[model samples]
Target: MATLRLYHAPISTCSQKVRLGLAEKELEFESVTLDLLAGDQHAPAYRKLNPDGVVPTLVDGDTVLTESTLINEFLDEAYPEPKLSPDGARERHAMRLWTHLVDAQLHPACRVVTSAIAMRPAQQRLDREQVLSDFAKVPDPALREMRISVFEHGVESPYFERALRSYVDVLETLESALSSNQSDYLVGSRLSLADLALVPYVLRLDHLGYSHLWQNERRPHLTAWYERLHLRSAYDAAIRAWEVAPAVEGMHAAGSAVHSRVDEILGRA
Candidate 1:
C-alpha cells in the first residue's frame, strides 16, 4: 500500500473529522498541516491538490480525495477491519444521512459561527486590507463574501444569527436522537462514521464555551453521549492532541464575552 499523505489544518473542523477517521482506523500517515489563517490553502501548489483551496486533501497512492466526508468513507472502504460504518442496510442509510447533513448544513453553519466567534479576533489582529485581500482569493464567491461579512461584523453579522440557529436545531435533533436510540453512538451500538462526523462540531461549541447547549439537564442524553465519546482514546489522539493552546484560549474568551448575547439570540435569555 502506498503511504497516505494528508494535507490539513489543525483547528479546521473538516480536517479534524478526517483525522478522527484515520485515528479510528489506526492508520499512520504523513501530515502536512496548513496554516489556514495565513492563507496557506490559497497557494498555487496546495490548490493543485485541492482546487477548492480547502484543508484535508488526502492522497493515497494515485487516489486523491477532496471532500472530508468522502475521504472518510473512502478510508473505511479501503481499510475495513473495525468498520467505521454500520452493518445493516438501514443503519448504513442513517449513517449516510448524518454525514450528508454535516456536509450540507452543519458545516456551513459551523464555518459562520466559528468565524463570528472563534476566528474574528484572530482575523482582526491582521491588517484590515490584507484580510480583505486574502479572503478575496477564496475560490467560492459566496464563502468569500460571507467571510468578509463575519469578519467585519463579528456576531453582529446577519449570517451569525441564522448560523447559530442551525446549531440549535442540530443540538435539538441530537438530543432527541440520543434520547431515542438504543446505543450511545448515533446510528448503532458502536462508533460509526455518523458519530465521527458530528463530534468535531459539538467539540467546537464546547471549545467556544457554549457547552450550555448540551450540558446539565437541558440535554442529558446528548451530554452523556458526548461524554462517552470524549472518553475514547481516539478522540484524545485525533482531536485534543491537535488543539493549539493559544487559539483555544482566545476562542473561549471571545465566546464567554458573548454568552449573554448568544442566549438572547436563541431565545434562552
Candidate 2:
C-alpha cells in the first residue's frame, strides 16, 4: 500500500471536508499545507498536481485525485472498515444527493459568501492591482468575475445576496431533513458521506459569525444537528486542531461588521 499525501489549506471548506473524512476513517497521511492568500496554489510546481490550482488534492501513490467529494468517496471505498457510506442503495443514493447538492449549489455559494464577507477585509488591504491580477488568474471566467465583484463590492456585490439566500434554503432543507428523519445523522442511522460533506459548509457559517442563520430557534433541528456533529472527535482532530486562530479571528471580525448588511439582505432586518 502506498502512503497517502494530502495538499490542503487549513481554512478552506473543501480541505476541511477531506480532513474530516480521513479523520473519521482513522487514516493517516502526509499533509502539505498551502498558503492560499499568498498565491501558493498558483505556483508552477503545485499547478502540475492540480491545474485548477485548488487545495485538498489527494495523492495515493500513483493515483492522484482532485475535488474533495470524490477524494472522500475514494477514502471510504479504499478503507471499508468503519464505512462512511451508508448501507442500502437507497441510503447511498440519499447520501449522494447531499454531496451533489454541496458540489453543485452550496460550494459555489460558500465561495461567494466567504469572499464577500470574511475575505473582503483582507483583500481590501492589499494592492488593488495585485488583487485584480490574482483574480484574473482564476481559470474560470465566471469565478474570476465573482472574485473581482466581491473584492470590489463586498456585501453589495450582486453575488452576495443570492449566496445568502442559497444558504437560507440549504439551512431550511437541513432543518426539515433533521426534523423528519429518525436518525441523528443525515441519510442513515450512522454518519455517512452526507454529514461529512455538509459539515464544513455549516462550520464556515459559524466561523464567519453567521451562526444566526440556524441558531436562536430559527432552525432548531439544524442547530441541534450542527451541535451534535461539533461534538464528534473527528471534528476536533480534523477541523479545530488545524484551525488558524488569527485567520478565524479576522473572519469573525469581518463577518461581525457586516451583520446589518446581511440582515438587510436576508429580510431579517
Candidate 3:
C-alpha cells in the first residue's frame, strides 16, 4: 500500500464514508483532522489539496482523490483484497445507482438541513465575519448561497423546507428499495459501495432527529436495513463513536421542530 493520508473532520458525513471504506479494507493510513466548524477547510494550505474545501481528501503517493463516493471506488480498485465493490456489470450499475441517489439527492439536502438546524448556531458563536469570508471561497455559487441563507435565517429559509422534503423522499426511496429486495444491503446481500455511500446519510438523518421517518412500524424494511448496517464495526468506528458537540445538541433539539413541521406536511403525525 502506498502511503495513504486522509484529511477529514470529525463530524463530516463524507469523511465518515471514506473512513468506513478504509477501515473495512483494514488499511493503515495517517489521519489529518480539520476543524470544519472553525473554517480550517478554507485555509490556503488545504485548498491546494482540494479546491472545493471539502473533507475526506485522500492522498495516495502522488495521487489525490476527492468526492467521498469516488474515493471509495478508487480505494477498492487500488486495493483488490477484501473488495468492497461488486463484480458483475449489472450489480455494479445497481450499486452505482444507489451511490448516485445519495450523492445527487441526499447529500445536498443533508448539507442544507444540518447546517441550518445543527451547525449554524455553533458557528455563530465563533467569528461570524470570518465564517462568511470562508464560505465565500466555496467553488459552487449555489452552495455558497445555501450556506449563507441557512446561517442568516436559520431553518426559516425556504431552502430548509425543500431540504426537509428531499430527506423524506430519500427515506421513502430507501423503504421501497428495501421492500423490493431480499438482501440486507441496498444492492444485494453482500455489502458494496452502495451501502457505504448511504450509511452516512442515514446517520445524518438520525442525528438531525428525523429517524422516526423509518424507525417506526410504517417503514419496517428500512428500519431493519439500518439495524443491519449498524452492526458493522466500521460503521461504529467511522460514525457512531464520535462525540457530539454542544452546538449539535442544540441542533438536534431544533431539528425536532423541523421534523414536526415535516410530519404535518406528510400527514404522518
Candidate 4:
C-alpha cells in the first residue's frame, strides 16, 4: 500500500469528493482532521500545504496535490481499476464540464441558501441589500467582466443571484440529460466521476431538506439519478462519519456519524 496522507473535515463537499475517489480506489490513508470550525485552516503550518485553506489535501509519497477534481483524476488514472472516469475523449470532456456544473457551480447556490438566505432564524433572514453587497465583493477584474457579460445579454443580472439561478437551471438541464438515457449512470454504461461528482450535491439536497425540490413531480430523471447513487457502497462509505453541511451558513457543528471503514483505514495512523 502507498503511504497516503489526507487532510480533511467532515462537512466539506470537496473533501467528500476526494473521499469517494479514495473509496473507489480502495486505498488507505493517514487522515488528520482540520477543524474548519476553529478556523484552523488559516493557521500557519496547515496553510503551507494548501494556500487556499481547503480541506482534503492529498499527500502521496513526494507528490502533494489539492483540488478535488484533479486529485480524483490523479487517483483514477494512476490506479485505473474499478475506474470512476469516462473512457473516451469526448465523453471525458463532457463529464468534466458537467461535473464542474454539479460540483462547482451548484455549490454556491446550495451555499448561498444554506449560508445566508434561508437557513437563518426568521428574525435573521439575510438582508437583501447585503446579499447584493456580498455579490459586489468579488474583486477579481476578470470575474467582474464575466458578470457584466451576463447583464449585457439582457438577462436580469448581478453576480450572486444570477449565478445562483444559473446553477438551479443547470439542474433542470441535468434532468433532461438523464431523461434521454434510461440508464441510472451518467456516461455510457456505469458509474463515472460525473455520477460521483453529482452525488454529493444530491445528498446535500437531501440533507438540506430540499429533497422535494427535485423528484418525480419536479424533475423525475434527476431524482432517479440521485436515488441510484444513494445506494452505492462507494458513496455510502464516503458519506459515513461526515456532517451534513450546516443548515445555517457560517455556523459549524459536530455531526452524528463519527467514523467508518474509511476512518478505520486512516485511524490506524
The C-alpha TM-scores of every prediction are 0.98, 0.98, 0.93, 0.73
The digit string of per-residue lDDT tens for model 3 on 4-87 reads 999998778899889889888888788899988777888899999999998979999999999999999998989877888777
Displacement of residue 11 (Cα, Å) in model 2 is 1.2
**Candidate 4: minimum summed lDDT over ten consecutive residues — where?**
253-262
* Better by lDDT, candidate 4 or 2: 2
**Positional deviation of 29 in candidate 3, in angstroms?**
1.6
Stretches off by above 4 angstroms in model 1 are none
Against the unseen true structure, what C-alpha lDDT does each candidate score? 0.92, 0.91, 0.84, 0.64
lDDT value for candidate 4? 0.64
Error of 4 at 235 (Å): 1.8
Please, what's the RMSD in Å of model 2?
0.9
TM-score of 4: 0.73
Clashes per model (N, Cα, C within 3 A): 0, 0, 0, 1
Question: What value does the lDDT take at residue 37 in candidate 3?
Answer: 79
Residue lDDT tens for model 1, 94-133: 9999999999889999999999987888888998898898
> TM-score of predicted model 3?
0.93
Decide which is better by TM-score, 3 or 4.
Answer: 3
Residue 15 of model 1: what lDDT? 92
